[model samples]
Target: MILKTKKPVVLLFALLLSLVLVGCNKTAYINSNNISEPSELKEALTQQNTVIIDARSAEEYAKGHLKGSINLTAGELTINEPVKAMLAPQEQINKVLSSKGISNDSNIFIYDNSGGVYSSRVWWTLKLYGHENVKVINNGVNAILDNDFELSLDIPSIKETNYEAKEVNSSYIATIDDVKKAIDDEDTTIIDVRSRAEFDEGAIPTAILYPHTKNLYSDGAFKSTRDTYLNYNDLGLKKDQSIILYCKSSFRATQTALLLEEAGYTNVKIYDGAWLEWSTKDMPKADKKPSTPATSQDAS
Candidate 1:
């Protein structure tokens, strides 16, 4: 009789190898070059056809912002989809970008006041929509002013461009079900990208604590690629393993996921609902401080 068991075992091994390769090939849309320094940006402005975007509230932008920069907040890029803060419809995104004179051919640079936090959100949105060239200025508006550059109160007249929307890249974002599967997958690594206090209070089971600030400098600039790699490498993360990132509401997770992806990680995904949906879904949550106060950090 034929040995049926041996053939089945060989098939299983082949399947596992194929899955690993797929994970390895899941590279992020952006890379390390997406991070720009103030001085370098100043020089680039002279040569490159660039569109600088200030990702802050309108009120904040009115106070003062970089000259020639357009104001585009996180709210404009998203809508109330199945979950709050989900990316907006393609038409909306295209309208916003085109109105701001942003085009697929332009080198887009984004920055925010609160560290690189809000800027990273805009970066994620653009990449999700398949805008090819985008970067977040290291530090932020302060980085520009600190270099003795000029700031303007006047809003520049925007000559709109035809910013088309490409196919949405769904691989960068993860769902609650995907997270549940990751929890059970031995090769998956779940990272908690919140503050130390927030992580100490409660987190997903088996998730590692890696604060988003750890990847940023006091000046708000992202650390060098070598430094960024070392920080995550300390956690014994492999370059090819699948990683799921989550924070209070998913903002910090997107920021942290970008850093990890820039540092050469092959597979990185953000849980858009993050802790908000995870806790509500009756999923496994571990609280290191079970007696902590009920009023914790805001999800946003």
Candidate 2:
């Protein structure tokens, strides 16, 4: 008869082994080469086949843009109340993709001037449309200049290709109806990832402000665990809750989505159309309550 062992050593060893196995299984698959340095992008540009999209305003693009890049302004999409309408229709998106010689197989790199607000939006949009080989160039134009990449003032001629547009994943996007339904359901949490002014002045009837920046220029290229904890904790968000994030036009929301996912929030979705799409129609907006507004500064 053996004496009673302390802490059940054998049992504890078995439990530790099980935890190790579980940790190995919980892998996060973030898109690669998506937020690379300008040097990496420059090398990719010189490759035989690569599509670079300049997601800056036309004015900024006209001033100066990367060589061999196509223009797709993120701000113009929001000028119209309903931003969805501004987004090229499926046929138009397909047409442009074809005109730019971009196919399902082409490796695409997208970037913008204001941090990654536009570039991330384009990245999420491409993913929504089932284009998996898409990446966002972090730090936007400044990163290119810092890396000493060449810029061109003249627009290059685009060669058209036959690109087919497949159905987009609705789960990744939320419509006005979906937001309303989530409010009515009471089981879901709707997060407004916009500035406090945007949220307090008037916002989706029941959404709480969870503002987040695109995290390219100041806060590095990707969201880390600490960033998630700070943002989520400040907003009083629960890790287990089913969260939906949205911003003026889904740019910042996409960044928040990535952060939430990194924070172990299993069910997270981005309302790509966001407030730009929600506020356009006669959708309900929360009454403005006088309160201290949160700043849109980069999370340190």
Candidate 3:
């Protein structure tokens, strides 16, 4: 008689071993080059090819903004598409960039008054759309103002150019199916970057609760590269581990995603639908917490 059970057991062992080896061969990486200091930016802005994008509200930009900077809000870069804040289509991004006089070769610098949150959003969107020559101002617009850079109400004349986006790389984004598969995949980690209060209300079951604020320092700047690497590494996530990030609408998730990718995490993807789409579906959610608010220092 053939021993059918023994063959099945051996195949399972072989499959598991292959996965283990793949994880072991992957290397961890950490870098801090994407962040730009104010002094360096001050000199760079004098060059004709350098472009500064102020990612603030129109009202705020009208009040005052960096001289020679183009005013573009994060809202201009998204679509409802049934899911609010989803990254807009490539053609739409092209129009927005072209209208702002942004070319693919421009040495672009982005910033916002609200820490790096809004600026990071723009930076991530550009990177997703294949513009690799971009940087997020460290600590955001405040850093520039603190350096005595004056804000101008005068709008510099913009000579629009044809700024066509390159073919998008779909690997940077995730879909509902990816999340479902990742939920059961040993190699993947699903992260929920919502506030603790929001997370406690309900989150993807098994998703790690890491609030977006955790990526920021007390003064609103992003954590150093080493600190950011340490924070995620503490979660037992290997550098090569597949990560799916989502927040209420994945906006905050983008901030975390940017930091992770900058630190050399190669497999990061954003769940564009985020909780908005996930909650409406029949998928599982986390157990509700106690009536008392989360007291953890990292909560929200």
Which pairs clash (backbone N, Cα, C closer than 3 Å) in model 1? 139-221
Q: What is the lDDT of residue 249 in candidate 2?
A: 69
List model 3 lDDT by residue over 68-117, tens digit each.
89998888999997878888999999999999999989999888877566
Ranked by lDDT, the better of candidates 1 and 3 is 3
- Which runs in model 2 stand beyond 4 Å of their true positions? 1-34, 74-87, 184-187, 214-226, 233-240, 258-266, 280-283, 288-298
Positional deviation of 17 in candidate 3, in angstroms? Answer: 47
How many angstroms is residue 252 displaced in model 2 relative to the true structure, after the best TM-score fit? 3.7
- Order of models, best lDDT first: 3, 1, 2
Count of residue pairs whose backbone atoms collide, per candidate: 1, 0, 0
Evaluate model 3: give its lDDT.
0.80
What are the models' TM-scores? Answer: 0.81, 0.73, 0.84
Error of 1 at 97 (Å): 1.2
lDDT by candidate, in order shown? 0.78, 0.67, 0.80
On TM-score, the stronger of 1 and 3 is 3
